[model samples]
Target: MTAVHASSESPSETRKFLVLLVGSIGVVYGDIGTSPLYAFREALRPFSDDGVQQQEVIGLISLMVWTLTIIVTFKYVLFLLRADNDGEGGTLSLLALLMKQTGSYMPILFFAGLIGSALFIGDAMITPALSVMSALEGMKLVTPAFTNYVLPLSAAVMVGLFAIQRKGTGAVAKFFGPITVVWFLAMAWGGLIHIGDDWTILQALNPINALWFITHAGWAGLIVLGAVFLTVTGAEALYADLGHFGRKPISVAWFMLVFPALALNYLGQGALVLGHPETIHSPFYLLYPDWALLPMVILATMATIIASQAVITGAFSLARQAVHLGFLPRLLITFTSETNTGQIYVPAVNILLFVGVIVLIFSFGNSESLATAYGISVTGAMVVTTLMSFQYLRSVWGWNTLAAAAVLLPLLVLESVFLAANLFKIHDGGWVPVLLALAIMVIMWTWTRGSRILREKTARNELPLESFIRSFEKSAHPPATVPGMAVFLTSHGDTTPAVLLHNIKHNHVLHQKNVILTVRTSDKPYVSDDHRATITPISDRFSKLELCFGFMEQPNVSKALAICKKRTELKFEIMNTSFYIGRRTLIADPNSDLPRWQDRLYIALSGLGIDPSDHFRLPANRVVEIGEQVAV
Candidate 1:
């Protein structure tokens, strides 16, 4: 029976893998696939101002090709993919894995993860503005008459994209893969036809030319190198989306399709510029004949829109992770798909990104200027990822220091160089991402610190759970007993919940069966059903229930309680159960450990947290909230 079952499922498994491969191409590769539209043009701009030189063109293209090889192909696809936390990847996931392995927090690693996450959010804001503008800019090549419409069109596209996010991506996701595949093929065809424009462009395949260009071009080369980094900007998405598609399909899509198409298109642009230096102004679009210009423009816009959508979705996922990990306050997370829990819409995040993108489009006015601001955040994120990966190599994989450094040091050096190059653009436009990242970092730091102080303060005054249970059991005159189950939710299971105490003081009665329930987020992406809930009996009337959810999961108290009934002696009907939650109204103290600004900020962030009843998916009618005032 087992063998027959395996045989019968083989084709179904194959189909699923193929589907994932295509999906990876569409989402994972979309941002990087569209880089050719602006990367080469911007890189060549500085040198081509006087006039384009063949050596300069080949050398720049060589640098771009090698940068992609090292940064995207080797570091991310081959190396970092293996460092995933359980089946999940991303900075926070890696941090969670590291914490689980070491069983302690390392401040350096914590800040690295925080910074990486902040930069990723910064990247999310900029990608939509940069990509859509770059695509719309192609209209200028079609007819200068369309030039005036570019900014408005880009803004409209961005607004429309965010406006429809509440509707979800499930219906349109099926088309993303096929459309992107066509985009890649079109890029390859354009490049293939132009390779004959100058076969000598093939010399760019050698890494020596890239090295020569860097050494000889001096300061200008560093500036151009900043532009070169654009080729690999979206490469991090490959690792960030690991949990969504898994490593195999992402790697397969890159090796089989994305890389070849990018290489061909880039080389074609280089050859075109070298053969007809006049085409340097708009080499990407000039690769095709005049008749194909408008169609390609429309296609490029669609491709950019897809890229923007991927990053927006990624931002939502990252924000959700931050909330689960306690770096941020609870957010209003709306499930957009019935079957796929990962398909979510965060209204707060969506509005933030939309506002940022609009500000960028209006401020920069075009992709060229926006490109100046782009590299810093991305390169900063890459540097942080590299640092975390080095730590992972040593700690999790048990590699010796020498072995780990040998693998990561060179990559770190390269990323550091990219970061340094991008830093030079700060005066021009790079300050945008830096400022955005700093603001987010401040928010995260304030929230985490304030939460800790509040936790410690609350713990100081609260009674121990065991002691309270024992005293109540030994009391000569106990409170009147109710006939239903009472579930009190608390963050610290060791302490008696304030809400439970309030209930005893006011209502003056205890349930026939009482449970002190605590929900915890696990280090792993998911916990198995068998390990999801644990119950410990304190007495016949009282028991302790702990529900463990993965950082990637939504915590549903009601559902977990259902699982508990089957796994343990706990039994209760939803209609007969009442969940008690503590609602703290925090007041900021000037003399608090945090500065006044942070105290106020913390209070503001606290106000943003969703109601516990809604967040835990508890039945509103069956839930009761007890209020208290706390100062921090």
Candidate 2:
């Protein structure tokens, strides 16, 4: 069973109106939109280094467009985007969908998805620090005197930004769309002025420049592709955000507003570079006139803020998917809006991210330095996406050999090239995210198995209510003073009542009044009044009751106990009633069916977190943890 975590406005079918949709598109695209600041400038660096002329700058732009076309458009829009699990799309979502389709329990899918997503945490931390750093570096160009204080300014902004995690992003997000819109408009206008001055820059669209660079300088050109890949770093965020906006509007916003604006801005930067090669230091700032420089910097800074917000949003969503898929622990998820999933904030993630960003800012100092750490995570994720997509085709899409190979082969090569290029940066901060992702994935898999073993062990000895009641009637003594209630926190109603058996056998004096209470945590997020609970008496001396509750709603044992006390005629009282819980101790038994490691995991994890007495809403004062030594 999949776990459900917090959501903003848990999806509404009837009122999923346009404003909500468009807002989500803006939130989602912010990461990609902000890439124009450095993508082309970095791409054109080889030209500047080799003293390559105007003709070459135009050629790189052509390759930029085609990369967007092939990678983002063909793969994401045409194929991978459609591979969403239900409305959710991400590595974990794909894993879940694959598990459902294949009927084979493949551990590799879990590990790979976890690694891809965990590295994203590292990416998330650096994006904000570096994106802001890149934009603020404009101050150095606009005013050289401001150069020394850039880090202080960036730190201040980051502190203030992360400080508001508890407040939620709903209010600040209202301006995200308008700010981003204005920013894109400014980008296009700046590029248009430069593009208009020299329509010749349009030739940059010619795929030949990219080909020529690789043709002439194979290894060097291949290395720079790592930097070039940074331009599209946020494409995975777009796929991750699909659950928030749905595909159509995000696609529309990207194709219409984001795509053209980025393309023109990139061309504009190239034009500025080709026109005045001396100003290559900050071609993006110089692309516009002297008067627009300050405003452009401000707009660009705001755009980067929104981009950081998008990454933060992606982290929250990915964390939710992680929890649902058992790859993450419970997070304090706060929904920021009444009508959108895109507006969530994870306080734990936010705080950890802020600390990481600060370290990166001090260590890398600027975007260019941090750029080395950028594309490895994205390329690795992209590579995993391609591999997972192939599995999707075979398991779910049912595409024939030719159709599947046609799509997979080219992507495999491109992704491989990109992955290999980024591998060069492994010693230069690239391994940070990879390691973090591995740590998280291991924890996730461990906890899931541990919890499962506990559940399975508990379920194995379970007798059905009828059988349990029959055994209770045939095997016990009459009555005692202090009443005992067998409250079993359960689901599916298939497990045997081992606690009842142990209690009955050990204590011959049955409590004067007792009942079997089963608590049901349903898959649905919220339970209405009708679904609250149910109570049924079993026999002359016992009763069986089922209490239903939703997973998302906060469980109140006190309230449930009070209500159940009123609904049932059992003789148990709050002050006097005691809860019996059986805690399992796994001892090695060669005869046991479980894998040796699984038994060890169950014991370790059981010691770490999962205690049934606490997981259930039973009172600490009223509870007892009876240890039973059982060989695994």
Candidate 3:
């Protein structure tokens, strides 16, 4: 059941690239594209105390243009996208790549990745809340009468969005590209119409304007940077969805369409604000005409829904990666699309995010308030991405230390300033993402720590597979041999499985064909069919099977075994074979190395995972669980 999403053709293929480029626009650019709904208004809010000066508007526009160009276009699209892990990219994928290339499991690298991933989950929750609320708030422009309904309407839309996740994104995603294409076109048109009102706004393109604003506006302008950061909030999604669309298509979509559209929209908002000054309160929606207001609001809401859908799917994907990597406990995962392996639904994650987003909507009450909570986690994730990519550049790409530092120093400095700017916002509702990130980090740390302790415990007690075979060969009275094959499921490939030993000790019997099968999740996204399984023959009756799967894949022992049967000389019939699984009952030791609470926590968390049979897709009648109690 290992699921892998891959395109057989390269990104350079014209037909395929165009198709994926459209798909990338629908998915990858949704979050960033929808930012104009609230970003301009939020960034200019602090300037209201000073009566909305022209310099402030120009400077803010300049800041946004450069932020999108430097952060999204340069750092993410041009650079980090190229630093993918076996054609897959993300916080975890980047981590796996670093580990694979360097063969180093440094604690620094682990914590950096864990923190980045934790913040990503924070972004997952907040993005939907912010995007949906911002889009719905456009109704206020249609009529102030709609203001009272904005919060409830946003909540309802989000709840509906989460509810339909079980149905899969394949059906909804087909429409995403066309809808987003319309969104960008509308955005470009909206901006083009207003840019003519005040051509002076184009001067904001100079970085000097942004620098001048920051220096003169002082602390107030620094605070605005927090909001400006939102313009590129969805930049990471481009890398996360790399496997789905490929690199070239994403690059094309960004430069040719998304980037230009966003720039136009922002500049248009700046122009409108400068001309009327009063419209600074809602420059984004005001970019449209009186007749187009209702239509614009409808389109904006649809665009936000698409953005929310992308982040929700990303959360599911991230959760699956965490589970496969042993950083989190397994949850219920449903594959929504038969054709696309990447289209999966995680009910537990969806529910948690739904609750979090609903609470955010109800608590914040508007997109402006939620904007205060958004920028911190994104900037935090950006900082971590920069640090991790520094490692990739040096170790994986074989760049010299100076060269790597040269490439990363500017990004680190810029992100650090943004992070500090966001720090000032923590008391102003920024603590939401920070607290959420902390909780996720705890879960990940606990799972990783628990798994490590269990691995060490099992390794210490388990005998080697070769030794077991040798002892059986030298035994004075050999165990009675059954007629069919017995597949003992174990985590470690090099050692004897506990169930196999227990059966030999208690029942004094072994199957005619004994197969020691171990399933491993690789750091990459997909394992090729040819390299799926490695079979090592110990004896004619006893052989060892190692199954490798990518983190994004589902670990289906039955499916893998079938592939092994085809490629290797191993012989076994589905009906004739029996699967043995070891179920460990834990006894927490108070005097042990771990804290008592942690030991108890691990034991409690351990039971929350899916059943072994369900996880492996093994048949109920053919599987047997051998239970044994072990002290932690």
lDDT of 1 by residue, 539-578 (tens): 8888888999999988988888888777777896899999
Which candidate do you rate higher for TM-score, 1 or 2? 1
For candidate 1, the per-residue lDDT at 508 reads: 94
Rate residue 34 of model 1 by lDDT: 86
**Over 4 Å off, model 1:** 1-8, 103-105
Candidate 3, superposed: residue stretches over 4 Å from native: 1-13, 103-105
Model 2 CA deviation exceeding 4 Å by range: 1-18, 334-343, 449-467, 478-487, 497-632
lDDT of 2 by residue, 15-129 (tens): 4655554575468777877777877766656556667566566666666777777788788866777877766676767776787677554776666677777777777887898
lDDT of 3 by residue, 1-632 (tens): 12322343444466766778899999999988898988888888887866888888898999999999999989989998898888999999988888777756578888998999999999999999999888888888777899899988998998799989999988789899989999999999999999988999999999999889878988788898898888888888998999888899999999999999999999999999889888878898889999998998899899999999998989999999889888888787889998898999988899899999999999998888999999999999999999998888889889998999998999899999999999899999999999999999988898799888888977998899899899889999998988899999998888999999999889888999999988899988899889899999999788988889998899888888888777778966889999999888878976756788888888887887888888888988999888999788
lDDT of 1 at 404: 93
For model 1, the local distance difference test gives 0.92
Candidates ranked, most accurate by TM-score first:
1, 3, 2
lDDT of 2 at 213: 55
lDDT rank order: 1, 3, 2
User: Which residue pairs clash within candidate 1?
Assistant: none
